[model samples]
Target: MITNDTMQASSQGAQKVILTIAAAIILFATFENKMPGGMIGALGAMAIIGFVLNYIGDRTPIISQFFGGGAIVVIFGSSYLFHKGIFPTETADQITTFMKSGGFLAFYVASLVTGSIFGMSTQTLKKAALKYIPVILGSAAVACLLTGLVGMLVGKSFYDAVMLIALPIMGGGMGAGAVPLVQIMSGKTGMDAQTLMSQMVPALAIGNAIAIVMAGLLNKLGQVMPSLTGNGELIRGATAEVESEEKEAAVDLKMLAIGALLAISMFFFGTLLSMVIPMHPYALMIISIALIKVSGLMPKAFEQAAHAWYKFVVGNLTPALLVGIGVAYTNLDQIIAALTPMYFVLVFVTVLGAVIGAGLIGRMMGFYPIEAAITGGLCMANMGGTGDVAVLAASRRMKLMPFAQISSRIGGAFMLILATLVVQAIA
Candidate 1:
């Protein structure tokens, strides 16, 4: 028996949500032809677009079960919008500019890295460090070989297939993986930057899509074969007794704000170190944060704050960040134009190679095969930061962000170096 007041309040809430969405759309439309600046215009459009895609993905059955819901939807949907020219050029450009120069992706990664690492116990971190690096190296090697073999079978040259198809897919993500690889190739092979990007970007986009789908499939595999997963625990035989007793603090505005500051501060520290180290800021950040976590020096209050902030950001900002990726990073035209049976088969093989290699090595290292493949292998093959979140979500293992980041950042750098050497040898 619902009262009139309750019904009225429900109606009001629904109206508010609709009004907010409508307002966001209006703002996007207003700036359709103008290069809008600041978070208000660019981030606002992304939020609205991402929310709609997320909602649609969740309600859709096949997509939810097989493709990890909103993440895939947001990428493909935004790509569609851009492909059809439905999203105006100016609006799309604004989103891309913000994602790149405004450091939206950096901000998102920084928050997750800082919060997630601090929230974990020192013991789990230590156990993870022992076995994770092997999984990354093994996956990269396997993926490259399989993709190269498949390329030859499909009548393509081994170098082109490995460099253009396999390497990009396995290289981590766009900023850290594909973009840098393009520059390296252009310098060594005398290929135009645009030509190299044209070939590699599609592999990344399609590989990311497959990785997300494979994540969901792997999650299902875990259920059918329970022994193949640690059920969100990365370390084999790491007892849950200590972690189960740990309580999550009630999320509050103050705690969230504090968490935000901590995340940003750590990101700044990582950037500062990168000045001398010549590594990606994210790689430095991951190493620095892990040391801080393993050292047992962060205050409990600060740890809680980081944990709370990670939750808030992951829950609220993921879709927005994904929208930024689709608009700024994904090029639907390139992906579609590059589609062919051989290309498709090669991409599939690259992803499969990663899973097989990671699964085998992970089992040897005492990790669940399915979880290892998803985090260490698939996370590596997918587009960097956004792909990590999507694959983990699809596998229902958000707790593995630390390892996933390592796979993306450090592992990506490894691939870049490998590509450089390979090019030099062949040239």
Candidate 2:
């Protein structure tokens, strides 16, 4: 009884469903005795899982509104599955190997760091660069102080509060924050590095959860108090001066390839700089890209190409990368183990400190309070690269990535320095 068009539509939809099931079956097979053949298997599994979670999160009403859609869901859901032994051990191990040693995370971040910086308007870069650091520092100061106070009130020493809770929360997630911190603390205190790391890991995980959820809440807050947000714009009144539209860059496959080349080259350049200087490659990469952006070193067409590539990557790859994050980085077992009344209180206070501190100073600097709090504060509070993306995506402010990176990289470094000082004093 159906017309020709209806039959075609039904056929196509059925094909899509079949394709999804086939992919899912292939992914599951990769878990069977033999190792899934490397990148292809890993990416296919991540894509299938990530998109499914993304769909579930989007379709759910209230959760989507306040929790920033599928990011949190994907992370938690993947972790739960892993913890519950739903994902086979071999499969989980493969995903982890791909994420860490295979450099999936770095590859993903490099594209974002390169494209976002190059795509930004010069004036916005200049204005934001000059003013953003103080906002980060303010958030850090308040976060540490508040956490320290809360710990003391709960009968924990001020050092335990700041070092264990506050530092990890503000330290920028696992790679940039906890790993380096454990090394530094172990050297200073003669504690086993693994032991120190175990203590700090909970704070980082819990803090990341709080930050992601808070980002959604802050987005809603911005809407209720319209004056407090420039929507995705970080600076108030600065949006008018900036040409922030993505529509101008026509979608071209050649341009996308050029963009990928530019991003990878920039990442390598940062890696090269890291050899001569003792800084993270990402920080150097940010500095290098920002300098070129402000100096007008690249041509307009090059910039446009980079922007186009960034659009392609962000649009196409974010869900898959997030799935990689869930399968690899998020450890729900650790998070669950770390939950305690005092621990929860301290983490909550630290996030609260960031919101209050960044919000006040951001308002003073003519930035929307909600935007500032989320990017400067919550981004610092979340897990490093993935956390920044999750938090910003939840807030619908992906454009604020540059500032969020600043918080995670530079601000995380600052936290490390402070932790060293705090540990020295304690010792």
lDDT of 1 by residue, 21-98 (tens): 786766556346543567777887887788888889878998877667777788778877865788787778778888
lDDT for 265 (candidate 1):
95
Candidate number of the best TM-score:
2
Cα displacement (angstroms), candidate 1, residue 320, comes to 1.4
| Model 2 clashing residue pairs (backbone) | none
Give candidate 2's error at residue 157 in angstroms.
1.8
Candidate 1 scores a C-alpha RMSD against the true structure in Å of 2.9
- Put down candidate 2 lDDT per residue, 238-330, tens digits, no spaces: 776675543366768888899899989998999999999988888899999999988988988888888888777778777778777777777
> What's the CA error at residue 319 for candidate 2, in Å?
1.3
What would the TM-scores of all predictions be? 0.90, 0.93
Go through the candidates in order and give the clash count of each: 1, 0
